[model samples]
Target: MRNILIIGATRGLGHSLALQYAKKGMVVYATARYSTPQTPSHGIHWIANVDVSHEGAGRRIAAHWEEETKIDLVVISATYFASETFEDLHWDKEVAMYKTVAIGPVFLIQHLVHSGLLKKNSRIVLVGSENGSIGLRHESGGAGNYGGHGSKAALNMVGKLLSIDLKPKEIPVAIVHTGYLRKENKEGFFEHGGVVKPDEAATALREWLESFDMSKTGEFWAVRGPADIKTAEVVLGPLDTLPTPLQLPW
Candidate 1:
């Protein structure tokens, strides 16, 4: 079975992915700040207290994978979006926002690559958002308190560059824009008038992972439905000024 490493697995989409993969008989290394769920025993190894932004976090994760088997799949699901207004926060908090949102994933990828934990055919999936699409403006005009829109936009470009780098090595990288989920109820975004459910999002991610093909490396897909029906080029604008991955001030 494939060995899967899922970050942010304590709750939300990450939690659902961890449980689903474990049920499919894969060895899942689930990581999160808090404790993972303990209801069913499905051969899931919960790795807690993981802070991806820390310097040694990647090394620690790599070592853990070495202890058993290399990770075939890496799912980055952890993210932070504080409701802090630009006026209320200091520079330090701003840096922290980018750190948790962008830098953490970049560092983790670098660590995994350098640690020799990822196999040639290994797949890395970045959970991204439509908010990142520079050209794609939400009907709501992005009045949300969290910085999710900008952060997700930055992640999409990172995936593009990563795909270009990993393709020659036969490894594929992808970013999935898991539509807005109802944070509380974990249901469809439209059903609740643009609120998405974590469980539903997780289910979509699992389906995508199951059908992944190396040829589709560096591609971005909508997590809600028929990928072909929705074109990213139409949604995401040019990436001229997009933030570089891991370059955040944090």
Candidate 2:
């Protein structure tokens, strides 16, 4: 049985991945800051009050995992989003978001890999967004609401470097950019085809992870696809394809 470790599994994609994996009889170790109280099942395990942003936090998690089993699939599914423009965005807040979306996962993965808690044929998946694609402009001032776009761009680089580092170990890494989830659409980024269900996104992620070829490492896939999102597009064209979502490495 594959052991999957999901970081930041409180809600949305993370929560859905945890629940679905547990239902499928896979061992799921799910961590979150806060989660709705629920009964534990045979396959579902929970670790609460895990503030991933804390220094040395990854080591703590690794230490905890040393007690039982090694993980086969590591999912860094935690993300933070904001809608402030460059002039209006706070530097402190942006840095914090960067840590949450970028550095936190880097540290966590570093620790996990170093702990030797990963088995052969292991896979690492980082959840990211299209906003992070470099120099890709949104025609209608599209995803520029806040720093979500820029932070994602930073994550792209992180994903690339991580892939390079992990490749030698035969551990394939993939970064997926899921469509804007329904719950996060309070701002109506969904007026265009942005209405994919949370469950759908999670299912896509699971499928991709299961079917991914190690040779495809460092690829960024758009979940819930119309296959519309393109990689290596220097210029993001008009928003004609309202929800042609993309994922960038980082």
Candidate 3:
């Protein structure tokens, strides 16, 4: 896409995606949490104080958009991971998690659509997680991290509803498990059971997105496929049986 807008572009996959798009001479609009957003290099126009966890986060983006041209591809990659055990939990963190991962997207998309910043052919990609899938939970059987997983689950629902709402406009919305990401500065894919580096996940997803369209709207997917998922074989099918850009169950 020529015009790329990436929310939560401070670090991890968002940062890498922004850079990749900018390097391709595409117009990139990225956001950071604080007023003084980092400008690592030229081409990426960073918006300030656009915390998704807060209300009206999309307004911040619109305010800084000098040219509110229709965005071709919009990737919302903001996620807050809060570890919670059966013995310990934080209510505030969970609320923030939901606001950031789930609730925020609703308003963000609404703003984009209402402001005429998204076209009928525009694509909206939400970064949800495989851990969010209730259908896959029976096989994985992991406990705790309620907020982390729950928020993503909520995001899946959000994406589904957004897809339906935008259907009349012919816009497409989809959620994806971006893969178990290692630290942004990490090297090769190692440890944490195929925890991939940010750039690797970004590259795989960018390539796969070329074919994504209305045919795949309202669906969930694993951009890099079942290779990095722990419960993929048991929950879905044999590793070899699954395709690389596999569509995931809700």
Candidate 4:
């Protein structure tokens, strides 16, 4: 069975991925910012307080596994979003977003690689966004989300650099656009226009992962294709002309 580690598994896409992988009978190690539940699902193991924004988070995760446990996959899906405009930008929120989305993954992966937790053929998937694409900024229509968009763009660069470093070890690094997800609030759950549910995103992401290989390392992809990206037509082209599991521009 594959040994998979999913960072930020307490909720959203990471939670769905953990459940899906555990159902497949894989050894799933999931990290949460809080205490692990006493009753975790079968095949799922929880690592508590592995906040990606913390510098030591990676080392903490690496220490959890035994020497013989070679992690086949590591998916870092932790993210922080704080809406901002030029006049109302919050400094603390921006710092947190940068740490979670861009800086933290680099140090964490470095620690894992140095500690031998990630071995040859192991894949690293960085959950990013289409908003990260500099080319897609044209679709923003002057709407501002400075921290979220900027940090993800930084993440894409980080993933590319890590891919170059890990190439000698035959480790493939991929950055993915998980999709525009729906939001749940006290007002009741609501879809954000063309947003997808977390379960649907997880399924598509899993299918995309199955086909990922070294040849495609350092590339950015949209697992949900053009279906959930409202700006796909405006930015890239018509949806009908695009392929499923679209290869995204950097």
Give the lDDT of residue 73 in candidate 3: 93
lDDT (0 to 1) per candidate: 0.69, 0.71, 0.87, 0.89
Candidate 2 clash pair list = 83-145, 83-146, 84-146, 132-152, 132-153, 155-250, 156-249, 156-250, 159-250
Over 4 Å off in model 3, which ranges?
A: 36-39, 184-192
TM-score, structure 4 vs. true? 0.95
What tens-digit string does per-residue lDDT give for candidate 4 at 1-250? 3899999987789989999999998889999987876666787888998889888998999778743778999999989999999889899999999999999999999999998888799999999998898876674556588999899999999999999999999999999998987787778669767788888899999999988889989999998887766577888898899999999888
Residue 118, model 3: Cα distance from true site in angstroms: 1.3
Per-residue lDDT for 8-112 in model 1, tens only? 887778888888888888888988675556665477787767887576668777766634556789999888775655567545655665677677787788888
List candidate 1 stretches off by more than 4 Å. Answer: 34-41, 66-68, 84-90, 138-140, 143-146, 185-191, 226-250
| Cα lDDT tens digits for candidate 2, 92-128 | 7777788888788888888888888765578888888
Model 2 lowest lDDT segment of ten = 225-234
User: How many Å off is the CA of 36 in candidate 4?
Assistant: 2.0
Q: What is the lDDT of residue 209 in candidate 1?
A: 73
The TM-score values for the models, in the order shown, are: 0.79, 0.82, 0.94, 0.95
Error of 2 at 224 (Å): 2.0
Model 2 superposed RMSD (Cα): 4.3
Worst 10 residues of 3 by lDDT: 183-192
How much RMSD separates candidate 4 from the native structure?
1.7
| Candidate 2 steric clashes | 9
